[model samples]
Target: MADNLPPPSPSTSTHHDSTTKVTDMDIDSLVHCASYLTLHDISNMVLSCKFLNRVVYSDTIWRRLYREQWPEQEPYIISQTSCASAREAYLGRYTDLQRFKFVDPLVYDVHMGIGAKCSDLMFSNNSILFSQGPVIKILSIDKLLEGKTSIVSLNDHRARITCMRLFPLKETSLFRNKAQRNESVLVTSSSDHSIRLWWKGSCQRCFRGHNGPVTILSDKLLGDGTGKVFASGGEDSTVRLWSMSSGGKRGGQHALKATLYGHEKPLVLMSVVKHKASLLASVSKDSKVRVWDTTISSDRSSCCVGMTCVPGVPVGIKCHDSLLYIAAGSSFVAVDLRTMKTAFKTSTRNQPKLFSFDILPSKFLACTGGVGRAMLWDIRRSTGTGDADPMAELDGHVGPVTHLHMDSYKVVSGGREDPYVSIWDADTGNQTNILRSSSNLNLDGGGCGCCGMAADGFRIVTAAYNGEECVVNFRDFNNAVFYGAFSDNVTGSKFWCPSTSGHDHAGDESDV
Candidate 1:
């Protein structure tokens, strides 16, 4: 009865204390408090618990977590947060994972020299062309498969060849009514300050005007039915146009059409789009990219002069459809020709010195930098609103990556590293093959400093700075072999030329 007496009536006088204390707990502690939850679960926890809600809703904590766990999604996450209502405005825009195809390098070769620096490579038809010093090496892609030893060397340039382009013409009877039925022409530029045209079995004419070394050269098919115009740019800060026709009295001679000059520095890269037949874009060391109109007036048979300068020091430029893509510094920028304005810019987080870039047919752009890393960007989905990230980062190269070349399914990177040439699957970023330079079959002391790679069908060609060149057939992986090696002191660029007539055309094709 005493224990139940109104619960002992409570004390009338009580001591009261009025003080609020805040704890110095770190972000990690706050995150750990919600350890039993996933990210979505944390969001739910935030709604139900005030303390957990404040910690989860902290922008600094979330941003740090986003970058640490998913760097590629940082751009999209940041952009989404800038909206007034991120939950409703950007619900489907930010996914934090990417899948890539990995390829291994199957073949490897090396070339060593004092000042070897391979500049370019091309794969055309069945032949491969690479430049070193003042010569172009040509070889047969098929012979490499048969394990035959035959290499054709052409001493065509007085200086080091810097660039090359294969002008693809149709083999149809309607197109080549008079000239060689299925032969193709290779256009090359060199430090000897000249541009030359060459056919497989013939030494063609040279275009001379630049006082300095020719830096970049490219061509586009203009008009129809045997009428075509080729364009070239050089260190002389000029772009020249030439018309190719069957009416030449001499073989491979075309009429010079026009010369456009506005660049203050040597042109490093150039690209032409088919949609804008009269429009051409060039990037120079002067830190500017210029666009020119090549359309001819009704009365004046010469190209019309219209130019615009875009600000940037572009190291590489590529165009697909009506969109122009340029790689500058650590960013890749895309411009729409229709709007003549930048549409997209994505950061690679790489250092500025880059040697080469290649765009795949799947709209993925691969860029290599001086820092020995290669990044793949999905430019098609990247918008200025920042909703994209690099799909993959290739980190195998030990030194600076000089060049990147890609086909529909595979990618090859060249630089100063193990296995001078490395091949990967474009879809998964997985290594499919390792082309080592240490094989006994290699003649160029294993391999040289690979500068560029080009592919035609299943055959691949690699050019090195030490004047070493190799052609490999990937059809037989276990027995995949090197075709030939050119161990000359050639440098600059190399490429492959495929002959429509099913002729062997692989070699160390070089300029200068």
Candidate 2:
């Protein structure tokens, strides 16, 4: 009976459970397992066997890795090569980021065709709207790629172009429901004492009444999201209301809706809230600030509900919930709009004194003074320690830091003290590269300082001197996509829509 229990086995007598081959698993299961491995680990895994090679390259595995590595890139990563797979997209950015260690090799180009020093610059779609003296040059990215070098010029302003801003255009398109983002109208102020509205690169209307140069343009639109109305201020010491629609207008006074007269000194900076019945704050050269109820700016008049004065002339003013943050010489102070009193003042411990300050998307404070270094402070941490360690110190400028722009990917600082634009990784707070002009005068020579700088994820636009010519240098990082000739996505992007969703998308903005 015992002999009938299967014939004698020729194999080894001791046998355990049969080993399960990884290749035997389903494709999905294999792909998921490989995802846990690092990119380098998967690279080696694929070479070990043909089956793993296929699994490592699967969309499921690569997509997860791509986003994890560069969450700021699209959820579906778009490869810089245009034809590569998700794996290629991940590899490209990974390699590009590695260039931070050796900055001299970072590839870039300078386009002197953008004209002399850009006093004001901005990106509209793909084309850049930059001011060179009084002329506005619109240059396309494709032209630069093809080496055309030619640009469209708009010389409507008689005097120098002082400031420029973009506000969301009211959606009137038949396919409005399908649009992912709102179209915008360009609102530019000039020393010519005029405020012009432009759409699709064409000037639609002009409103003129300022007695002196139009020195101030509200950074945000007034009212809700209509985009038809805006406000302007000038050295004449008056805040004038302007609208796109003929909202119950009388004769030819539609564009010049109303005038708000309260300030005594010349206008320095102004800010407007976008919410309904939103409040507008205007800062004058005399350091006095006036808060007006913009929603009440109807019936031919708007009332100044609150007023306050700062230590010295302010460089910037921004409106938040019930408060106005002013950047002055000694300190960055937040003044309560309701009570007209100083609510809180940022620490003045750092030397050189606070020349100006900005509120980052993180709600942390970034300040710049006469010194070369830009400091980041976490005001929240100060609650427990009375004084918190500086969150990050960006110190790479050759001299005094002039301007800086920060997004999720990196922090860019530049100034008149030096010619180079220092790019630092925001996450690591490490210097990545130094961007300069291709010209010998800009590269080896002195006097070429960055007067102004604007950056997106893929490119950096700088206002520098190429010898004696003030040139707007377009330094492209060779991104696979560009929206227009000077289209700037992300970086200094303004989110018009107010939200309290509480979802964190920190580096989620790829800004193509």
Candidate 3:
């Protein structure tokens, strides 16, 4: 009876307050539970106590949130945020990214020095590779930042490099633990009718089979970012298979494994797939296509499994899934290999000739060729209906658009007659900056007729002409901490590298 009457006496009888204080929980428990709070809830929670403030504002909270949102950027961005608080890192990374358009990039010019004409610009890790005629040149990001033009040149190709591709080292982590961290490999095809393999600044193997100048090469990477075999097409109207793997030798042939014949005209472009049945697709100048299966092998030249004709001259060929997507002049076609029938075909009806095709931003197909602008198309549409109107158009080029490239952030397009490359917001079609060559940085800006372009979030690589000769320009951005280190020593520019203080720079005259 006494225990029954004493139940209410804990609050009244004990010398303690009857309040629910957040201090009742330990800091570890509070911090752990902070993950469940919305950012707004956390903000309110911090107002209650200094202890709550520290818990909610923990670095782990911001870092986890950042990683959850932008997992793809972790590898490229982790180094920059190491010392900063996760809150500062998140703010800097996010705010700096949002202001990329407002800021200009520091342009570092590199004259290939071998010749004035170069093409097939590619990026592997932090290095840029391009072909100046037959000379393969590579420049690294670290050296470029030092205002140096250090280049590693390989002159093994006897003639001009017609086409090239890069297989970069595999990015591995807990996410992709099974990936191979193979050394970067460069494959280049030349007018000498040979395809050569380059590894570690030297030519490893020279594959000879094409009868005429090799026009195109497709070396699509597999899961490990390493493909032992590759495909090359040439003026000889044949597609040949070459391998750099150890057991490629047969009858004293080091790399040449098989040859395929199906096109009536010279092969203009080739696209590869890892699909079991349809391994490759090649397009010819005469609007014909030849597809080969995984089992396609021959002592001499093998017969293709099928051939299809695409409308107009083929300008681009890219493979996705089991379908071969070919972009010809004023038309786009996708062939379903399993059914061997046209899946989806779109004709612009001579609108402006689609010149290039690429997969960008959630696998959208973008083309640049019609009317000095880049057009984004919906590649998933399977009807025979023609998409006369592109989803969006990026304009401002004065001449016919010739070169195009993009990454997660921007779409860079150049024209045949325009010296400047227009940088556009990928999500919105707004033109952000018109980047020019720093060749005449002190006086007048020079021409940069972009031949090939590549970009990551931090840098832009262009195989372009600097009015005098072909130069590969490296444009650096997002170095917020390093912006204060401005110097007159070659790589310095106040115009390009703006302050990261979140000020309005929309009206700044970057031309100076």
- lDDT (0 to 1) per candidate: 0.55, 0.63, 0.64
Output the number of the TM-score-best candidate: 3
User: On a 0 to 100 scale, what is the lDDT of residue 37 in model 3?
Assistant: 67
Ranking by TM-score: 3, 2, 1
lDDT of 3 by residue, 94-154 (tens): 5344324434456677665444576777777778877787788887777777877678889
lDDT of 2 by residue, 445-487 (tens): 5556776677655666777764565666675553322111112
Candidates by lDDT, descending order: 3, 2, 1
Candidate 1 has an lDDT of 0.55
Q: Between candidates 1 and 3, name the one with more favorable lDDT.
A: 3
* Candidate 3, position 87, lDDT: 75
Best by lDDT: 3
- Candidate 3: the clashing residue pairs are none
Worst lDDT 10-window in candidate 1 = 95-104
TM-score of each: 0.63, 0.69, 0.72
- Poorly placed runs, candidate 3 (over 4 Å): 1-100, 168-180, 221-227, 247-252, 274-278, 298-303, 380-382, 437-448, 466-468, 480-509
Compared with the true structure, what per-residue lDDT tens digits does model 1 show for residues 95-144? 10011111211433333234444445565566666665677777665675
